[model samples]
Target: MVADGTKRSRIGMGFLVGAALVAQPTAARAFNPFGLFGEDKPAVTANAVAYDLQVQGLDGKSDVLTAVRDVSILYRLRQEPPQTGDELVRRAEADIPRIVDALWGSGHYAARVSIVVGGQVIALDRPASGPVRATVDSLRGRALVPVAVMIEPGPLYRFDRVAVLDQRSDLPFDPAELPPRVVTIAPGDPARTADVLQAAAALSDHFRDRSHPFVKVGRRSPVIDHTARTVDLTLLVDPGARAGIGGIGVSGTKQVDPAVVRSFIYAERGDPYSRRAMADIRRSVARIEAIGGVRVREGTALDANGQLPVEVEVTERPLRVIGGSVRYSTIDGPALKAYWAHRNLFGGAERLRIDGDLFYFTGPQNWPGGSNRRGFNTDDIGGRLSASFLKPALWGTRNDLLVDAFVQRELTELYTSNVVNGTAAIRHRFTDSFNVRAGIEGEIGRSTDVLGRFDYGLLGLPLAASYDTTDKPLDPTRGVRVTASVTPYLGFGDAPDAFVISRIQASTYYALDDAARTILAGRVAFGSILGGSIGAIPASRRFYAGGGGSVRGFEYKSLGPRTLGGIVTGGMSLFEASVEARVKLTDTIGIVPFFDMGQAYAGSVPDGSAPLRYAAGLGLRYYTAVGPIRFDVAVPLARRQGERPYAFYVSIGQAF
Candidate 1:
């Protein structure tokens, strides 16, 4: 027999939040809020008594029953025996309202709970546990109590209809303005009470983002039908007045000019209030690593003229830092890198960094910088050192100036060589989607090939333009990124050639689902050197395709034109294409199947005579906070006489 309790009225659905509730389910997982356990009860002290609480008669609604059982205080009382039997009975009696709350949370409003303690019944409506408490106290002083809780969770309530009632006639109202299923409480679905309040807030935010600075969501009780098991909702909204931008101020800046902070703000005075504009400014400020914290506040409430003032506060981070990393690969053995950076060199968001790398401690020296000679040896080693400086906001525009210099010696399929290069570039971002750069570089290098040794100096002017709409640079799931660059070189010494090397590369990605669990990515690139013969251009300057970042199955630069001695001759033209299907099995683990093809032509342009090399590969990725750690192994599908049958690559980022 169940005791009838004084049931509280259901909570009315109404506007409560500043933003409209989207239908997106934000709950990570279904939870039993009352701490219900499927396992045996935990052991208690020998002196302490225990209670066995079982929630019975769940019918087919295990999910709802679990939610109520998990959070029920009666379960807690069992875990920790009360001081007296009467106290245990009292605790159970006082917990009926809380149990009802849990049932409501799961959209079950017509639930009834019956409690039986030691064969004595407890009434939920009586001011106390009454006769059950008296009987329990008389019979047991410090004995274990077995409690059985029988629950009857009736039909779940679902929203039959939902509407927004705009009370003010001065403001425009269109039913279509609200997002589809914003409340998430649709007809025929469980009407979660929380979704109703969330939807109200979402509606308010929708208007606020559109210049309604003082919009308000009012409260109203929803109409609940017991017989039909449905709820009808009407959300009240008071859109105060449309507002415009007012005075803007900046503060909390030290060691950085106030003008620089102000420069990042995109909103203008007297313009319509825009949340996107303000958010963009905040994002830009965060891009400067030196700025650690930021707060954007509306300084004034809506004025008589409907203007809201704004203020931005910033906290500066440490200007300088030092960090390093170490990586090991079967191809390169072990490599160590270290760097120091000054993010605000001149206090204008300028950056300066010095970096160095050392590798090839015990690997084959036959690769670049492995040895000073042409032949392969195990003792060959390579090292690199470089420095770069970047000046942001060049000339008060969204442009940057970069100067870089590097010296290194490395091995390639053709030869072991030493190179020194210096470059200066100016990059201008027209918008988020497009950018262009122009730069001049000078290089001096000496290299040895199977044929002989060569030395040269060169100067070049390089220009590049790109359009990127990818969501993430490290691992993009959607959008296209295209980049094209041309470099005109003037060589000095024996092989003086005024050749223009041009290249265009493009990558496109498409996510197969809303969660981006599966992605299709494709890439293609083409390059050619003009006005110079194969021998005239330096080996390092010529194009070649192979290795981790290129045709994976082939050895580094081994797929290009080759001499009679089987040595790779760097080609005058190059073409490469690849496609990968990336599938994320879990949030942190992913796999990719890829195919690659490339051709390196001896002539300035591919005339179809050069053989194309094809490779197929599988890759694994472990997603991390910074990026994915990638491991890939590939095999040549169309193997050539001298090409390695397989190749493997390991790196810290995506291949593309």
Candidate 2:
């Protein structure tokens, strides 16, 4: 093949030169080479030029040569036609230096390239347009060019020695004394220019992360030894003075008080300056959903007291917002929800929100002229209204206090009643990845179901905690999440009852590839109510599976123990598990195939007596920067009477 390409290149060059030499008549009318009569063109017209690329003088097929050829314009000219043969020659000549540079980038610094076209040695450094124009002036019409690129990649260069010179030894530790945390390449490793440059950058970042924000790295020169085929690098550094926290300033906050903003700072005055601590402060401030943006400025120079002055600037989001959503499904015909919130109530970064939702508004007796109530009752008109308040840094620490009050009337497969409740909770984050919460709640309600009708009052204590190591909360391709909570309730009204409800859930994600285009996700949850009969506990507190967020094939809260009349009486115990493979078919589109199984039982422990529900389905996802828009369709593996053949769901984010 090499010989054939060489022979073709020689012939191609000869043809071009011959056409130019025999072009005296065409040169007289160069401006209009068509014909003297303007319509009588030549019968023998030139064809479009094409080339055969060849790279020689290599021990084997080298990746460096492949990279060069892949990026060569000479090779691409065949796919993208050039106007003339001279233009083709110019591009081929220009690619020689580019090929050499690419070879050097791949660690072959001592590489040579030679370009031969039609048996003529074209000067690799010839000006692109000047000489090519003069040569092509003689040639007319179309022509084919055979090009050969011969490469001689010499011995690869490796690093011999790498050192950094620190001008200021006044710091606590010398650069030489400390461990090499930035140097990536060692002696005898290929001398890649990228690795050398990256090492310098990492070293500079090391000092900046260690409180030397003003540090500067200067004068980087790698001395290359051509004979030994090795590179020795020396980098000069000037690390300026280290600093301590001098003063903290907050600005750009209108509705949020300065004290609220200052509370996020992890470092106090007189403390040694730390970039990590400053970053934490920035993150803490950003997490306050009310904050639109945050900018931190470190003092360019230390103060007279030899400390740094830090400024925290933050823009506040709109203090109030009102929005709502609409949803529908076969189980629940239609539902609408509306909510309003004040992000910075009373200028303390406190939040107050009011929410209202109406469900089954167009079914049975809930709306006029309604008839399709197969899975619903005539009185299943349900609505809820609630108000909640939140205070951050309640005690000048990473703790939050929440207070809530709500009144609701609801109807379900199990029962329908009106209820009112109040709750108070305190949440504290122990670290960036772990947190705990404790709360107390009181309730009063009336419930009417197949069992009977009763009025009840209850008081409860709830404690919960979680550990999250996922890289992202909305969409995670890796890491684990775990949560456990227990709430104990004591009934005080006419029908007195008591129960302790506990739930534990966990999920994990693993990326099958580096790009995170494919992920295997799994989840499992267990919940139960101890020390109480299934009828005694409120229907809202009972455990049931089968919904968009649960076992998908079944209806919402429809998979559980039932009354003799066939009404679903939500169970006292629950267990569920799901596995999904999320594969991104494109940058914005993805597909998920999943399997789910779970069971709800009357007793605390989910014994083997009651059969578990199983479901398998496929889902589609349209990904965006914020999250994915999800659409799922699921069918039961084990069919049941009266249940729909399949279930369909639409929402945001992944199922897990």
Candidate 3:
């Protein structure tokens, strides 16, 4: 067998180069390569130029030399439109070098290849391009490349009985899929290397796309030989199966439900080995109720056919529930409190929180300052309970049912009050990037007027709707959210002439990272009491903005109309706006600094006073799987003679 001029230099080795015409190994069967797939493998004239693929000192004469592998097979092929036999030969002549390298890397160091005249690379049709049965026909023996080197495969390749070899051989590859999630074999036919690989690819894709995203499926080639002109092969495969959950075991971190992680796994005891399920499960081990990122995958495989004893290995995270400190700011003075919380409380994304605070404050005796408070005695205790149910795949979307109940009753020089409320709602996400929500809610409560004398009762039903899609709810990276709600007495006509009450809030955020990891957010909320004797609705019912979650600069519910005597005085309406930059500095920390503007009035700004109240501050946050721990210290820009320079806050998650 003699290669064209491009062959290795027999002369370079200073040896006599004889052009030996070796006998045809055997007549390749008369069968057509394409015909094996039930389509005719068309024959082309063997007219391409013969060439030798030369490598430094390497001889192509030895039968052991095989093709070398290239990173991207497709990239190496120089496409030559097979317009005619001659042109096809030219392309083949040019590609011989790459082919030689490929052959060698593939283990055939001395492979002898000859192109049938007008040789072409044949390819199978992708199922979707056309009918499966007919598509292969249309693509039958079609040339993907012209002037190709091919050993006439006597019997074309077809899958025979497959055997899996591994130290853990008990868990054989799923044979049903031929190339189960563990391995795939090309349909027995006149197969090309690419087609065979396409079959194998499904194994990795199926596993990664579902449970074992991190799994690495390395290639184990099928040996082929056409000496008898019959190429037979065996597939070498690695299960790459990781630990799956055998049976969930629980201990110390029991506050959060283990079921929460179970649902995330979407896997069961009998599920395939998975690392992801365990990771997600471990996140619920914490005490705080928050959102955290987790990865799941099959872990140690039990060498059993898909029926392996899966192991759920979790890397537990920081405790979610933390007994912590609390602090707040007010127009009167600054105060600190003690707090405790159970984050992943009932497990599965539920939260239980409690807080107790005490602060000493003094206020100026003036109409604008809401006068008459020079005191150091202030104490408060409050808590919140929230639970949620999330079903992402149901309803053709991700939907959630949430319920929350809260009470903040306190006795102070300012007031002695009791307030209780419960709310149930539904939230639906239409897209990973967009959301719409609507719900019906009701609240009933009573509280002491700031002066500790005037007591008021309030009852109302509120309807609300919102649209938003920020990366992080509390600290959004991009997108805008609009929320508006109105609470009206069930029957105004039958109830005390309380006409109608309404509140509206809107917020927007934009991501700074081109990747949208961090964001800049701004928000504004305005509310008013409208209807018969709106004043009768009580001080608690009147809308007020401020504190850690609201305006941030002032104390909670402190930004509203009031008298120098610190009474409800009277509230016409309230308006609050704030600008903040939410930075996801790292996976573990987030920070935000903001400016707030807000105020309350009784119909009109008392003739000569500017009703605008402003505060600005910086916040530090610690990121946890359960969201973030927040701390902010805000100061009022315009002090009313005797207000604190700064108000500090401690809480869970971002203020808003």
Candidate 4:
């Protein structure tokens, strides 16, 4: 029998003694810094006394045995021996119903539990009398107590009948009409409480997603029959009137224009109400750099027009931000990058960002004791500085204006170039997953390669289109992404040429399990430079592969045609493919085993001027709220004469 808490408190000193014993730490327990009664208190103590806890009658039902142990206070605290036999007996008595509840949750409606302490049986019907006190007193001086929790988990109950009823009409839905996926559970299925609750939730979502904003899932009723070992369950659903979109309100605007925010929302007055549309509205609004957070709220009651009104609440991020990052790879050495951005430059959600990257302090071939070792020079350093501006709603809410300019100096094994370039483009979003951009670009540069130094001026028109359905930009668990681009250029000065460059790349992700613990991902890319001779094309414009972002194990730009002097000169065509398996070992940690193959070709197509290179690697990922931190190690399957044995890379986000 449980003691009355009110009576125990009135008997002040007696209650305090029991509370102290339960609160204070002993040799068998450690102090909980969170609080004596904090919800995070450890269920099991490390220093608890040794005790035998036998769970019987579970047969081979390991899952049920695990469930029982999870909820049993006697098992959890067995190591923390109570200060008195009375406390121990009280704990054992409290665990009986909890154990029964656990059994019921697993479809065992008829269950029995028995607990024994020392050599005494604890009767389920024992009263709060002198005999109970005598049992406690008899074990008071015992150094150790043997405890046993015996359970008779009865027959697992299965569903005999399942029904869904509309509360408003007080009519049951036809079982044949209800979708099996939505209802989840059916007759003859195990009547687990979890599955029953999941079905109720799914039914509510099915209606809510179909323009019913006020859908409600009423109480669930279950009828159990111990004799037949079966349960009859029914769920009530209340789907309110269907509604359309009404007035939209915007709030929490500090610096951004409210009209601009509203324009980004996909919903319009009188449009059909849809959960997907609301989600799109949230995503579009949140994409603005000025917005830190966004929330879409639907009114509880329809307006006079019988349509739902929505409120858009937004939180503004800081207007100015300065951030930087560092990355390293055994092949590329070390790199440092930094950026500064003005999110709301002119108050209409215009964005301006300036970025700088410095890389390759020491050339890859100059590493100490290498085959091609050389001393470092200032010319070995490479960097780029760029600035970009974006004006949203340039023509309409779906269009944006982008302008960019950059000055760069690139030093690699294949070439060295210094260039200045600029571009102006208009990007139009046809839908959330699709977009296209067309732009005019101008470049003036001087480059040195195996063909020798030359100065050139070039003007070009560039166009690109992309489609993406991945769940995340940094790390994706599903969906496919494809991008295609074409650029045509006219050259002047020392090298005069006319040429076009076209490329297409596609990648896809698939989750192998429902929980996304395992994933299969693949990528393929191809590019070609048409109409221009190898010597007439700029080294920067030529195709090249082999690096952390390409073949992984090989040096950057080291897998193309070579000059008579054996120096890599890049190529006119490129092809690459990669496949990887991502497996999670724990919630926050994962491992990826990947294979990559590709090569650059000297001709307009892969004419087999050089055989394709192949590499294999393993990666580690530390998942976080923003993205996963990645570390990868790779080795070439077929080692070339001059290549390193292996390479390692460290950075953030997935390799793709």
Could you tell me every candidate's TM-score relative to the true structure? Answer: 0.80, 0.66, 0.42, 0.78
lDDT of 2: 0.72
Write down the RMSD of all candidates, one decimal each: 6.5, 10.8, 21.0, 8.5
* Cα lDDT tens digits for candidate 1, 522-602: 999999999877777878778898888888998877777877866677888999999999999999999999999998889
User: Which number leads on TM-score?
Assistant: 1
- Worst 10 contiguous positions by lDDT, candidate 2: 15-24
The positional error of residue 334 in candidate 3, measured at the CA in angstroms, is: 13
* Top model number, lDDT: 4
Better of 2 and 3 by TM-score: 2
Candidate 4 accuracy as TM-score: 0.78
Give lDDT for model 4: 0.77
- Which residue window of length 10 is worst by lDDT in model 1? 16-25
Residue 371 of model 1, lDDT score: 55
Winner on lDDT between 3 and 4 is 4
| Residue 188 CA displacement from its true place in model 1, Å | 1.7
Identify the superior model by TM-score, candidate 2 or candidate 4.
4
Counting clashing residue pairs in each candidate, in order, gives 21, 4, 64, 2
Stretches of candidate 2 exceeding 4 Å from the true structure: 1-250, 265-279, 296-311, 361-380, 395-397, 510-520, 564-566, 581-587, 641-645
